[model samples]
Target chain A: MLDDVVFWVLAVVAVAAGVAVFRVDSMARATYALAVSFVAVGLVLLLFDLQFLGVITVLMMVMEMAIMAIYMIMFMGMNPALMPMSMVHAKRPSLAVAVVTFVVLASGAVLIPWPSRRGAPASDLTVSLGQALMGSKMLVMMTVSAVLFATIIGALVLAVPRGRYDRLGDDLRGRVDADQPDGAGQ
Target chain B: MTLQTVLLVAAALFSVGLYGAISQQVVVMVMMGLELMLNAVVLAAGGFWWFLSPAPDGQVLLLVVITAMTVEMAMGFAVATLLHRTRNEDMTDMATDLAQ
Candidate 1:
């Protein structure tokens, strides 16, 4: 009974914070609201016995929100994100669509005849998960690693305003570029 | 703790995200909407694994989802930076020229 209560409370917090993301005026508030929503969902995952995912979710989301706040402040020209501004557009149609989607999904959740569990859970979930990653799912893990590396490189390439060529000169042997900002270079 | 209740919560979260994604004018706000939607997916997947499958594969799937969310958000920030630098615009409506 206590578990159910906790789950419901987290669920409410998650959904309410999600709603607040758009309702809030400032971009920082919206970003932190989404972070709160993710943290609540992470707690719900913990309730479901997904320890690694729950903890990772909390950590990753908090970090992501912090980075997002930095980007919002940095990228938003004229300090618009810092000022109070309307965050939404075409609100009526969006509301209608969201309402319809929720109704359909909720009805399906209540009406569908779900399958029963066929077997019990593993005694040591983390051990089994590690074994699976090192065993049958090794290929998937490798691919994901590659993808993550590529994402890091790709995002950096896109985000950096000046390339190495510009910083290092044609021969790539410049000690420090004149245009380089302080504390930005090694 | 029942599947129905968990799913209902997911549905609510997803719908709110949908609203934000569709209605938000700012690029980062839209990304936040997308993240919220993925957050709902994570919750629903955890519920499914706990109540139905109870396997390592489900956990792996959640991990992949989280990784994808991270990758997508990173790329989104990069793209937003590029757009702002090149066009000096952040609103979706201002980028309509890209559709041409």
Candidate 2:
């Protein structure tokens, strides 16, 4: 009984926040909303007894949003959260496509006949997951990890323009502090 | 009521997010859209886990997905920051200059 209530409440919150991610006018606001939505979903995952995934989701999103906030501050030079900049563009086509996709997918979800239970249920679900992943999907996991590493390297190369010595001088004892080149960093 | 309902909800959320990614001009908005899709993936994984059985594998896959989301967002921010440095604007359309 309580589970049903919790599930519905969470589902509503998650979906609402997901909508807010697009509805909000500013970039920072949308990012925060998305973060909230993910956290809510993480909680729902917990309610479903997926403890490992739920906790990881919360941790991961918090860190991701914090990093995003930093970049917003560093780049936009305004409170990206408060700005009323319109993030939307090309709205009519987007809305049409989104609605059509939703209808088809939702219809399938409601109408399709899913596979029913077969064979005896496993006593330990986590163990079953481990066995399946290790047995069949091990390569997939490795590929994902490798891709993540490459992304990190690529980001670093793009973001950092030059080493510390380039700006601070060879001895790192330059008067570049409080000095503005082209009046940047204001 | 059933797994299909949950999966449908996930699918709707994913499509909505995809639209946002395609429609938004700002980099941050695009990232928000990506996060939305990742959230849907999490939901789908959970639904599979529950309906399939009590196996912890769905949960584990979700853990990996969450981790991937984090790494991707971090790198995305770094790229955005770089772009902002080169050009003071955050709109994707303004990022076309590739020359010194």
Candidate 3:
């Protein structure tokens, strides 16, 4: 009974914070609201006995939100993210879509005849998870690592306005330029 | 406690995210919506694993989804940074042309 109560409470928190993400005026508030939502969801995962995933979710989401807050502030131009502003557009249609989606999904959840469990859970879930990663799912782990590396490289490439060659001369042996204005290289 | 109950929560979270993603004008706000949706998926995946399968494969799937969420957010921030730096615009309506 206590577990059920906790689950319900976390569910409310997760959903409410998600709603607040769009309702809040400032970018920082919206970002943190989403973070709260994710943390709540992580706690729910913990309730499900997914200790590692739950903990990782909490850590990753909090860190991601911090970085995202910085990016939102840095890129919003003239510090408008700090000021109150309308965060949404085409509000009516979006509301309609959201409502319809929720109704459909909720109905499906309630109406569907789910399958029964065929076997008991592993005694050591985390150990089994580690073994799976190192065993049958090894390829997936390798691919995900490659993808993460590529994402890091890709994001850096897209974000940096000045290339190495632009900093150093085309021949790659110029004095380190200093005190250049933004967009001066172009 | 039950799978249906967990799924109901996921559906609610996902719908809110859909609303935000469709309505939000700012790039980062849209990305927040996307993250929220992924957050819902994580919850549902955990619930499914606990109540139905109870296998390590489900955990692996959850890990992959979370990783994808991280990658997506990183790329989103990068694109937002690029857009702001190059065009001085952050609203989606202002960035109508990709060829520009």
For each candidate, what's the DockQ?
0.84, 0.56, 0.87
Candidate 2 clash pair list: A125-B54, A125-B55, A125-B56, A126-B56
Docking class of 2: medium
Interface RMSD of each: 1.0, 2.8, 0.9
The A-chain TM-scores of all the candidates are: 0.86, 0.75, 0.87
Lowest lDDT block of 10, candidate 3 chain B: B91-100
Instruction: Give the alpha carbon lDDT tens digit for every residue of A1-186 in model 3.
Output: 999999999999999999988887788888889999999999998887888889999999999999988877777744645688786788999999999999999999999999987677788878888999999999989999999999999999999898766777789776666675543343
Candidate 2 chain A, poorest ten consecutive residues by summed lDDT:
A177-186
For lDDT, candidate 1 versus 2, the one ahead is: 1
- Mark the regions of model 1 whose C-alpha exceeds 4 Å error after superposition: A77-82, A165-186
Candidate 1's TM-score: 0.92
Query: What does the lDDT read for residue A98 in candidate 1?
Result: 97
- Kindly report the docking quality category of candidate 1: high
The reply for model 3, stretches above 4 Å from the true place, is: A77-82, A166-186
The whole-model lDDT of each prediction reads 0.89, 0.75, 0.89
How far does residue B57 in candidate 3 sit from its true spot (Å)?
Answer: 0.5
Q: Write the per-residue lDDT of candidate 1 for residues A1-186, one digit (tens) a residue.
A: 999999989989999999999888888888889999999999999888888889999999999999998888887744645688795788999999999999999999999998987577788787887888999999879999999999999999898888876677788787775555731265
lDDT of 2 by residue, A1-186 (tens): 887788778778888888987887666777777778888888877776666567778787877777676766766787877887775678899888888988888888778887774344356555665666677777767776788888878887777776455666789765555464422233
Of the candidates numbered 2 and 3, which has the greater lDDT value? 3
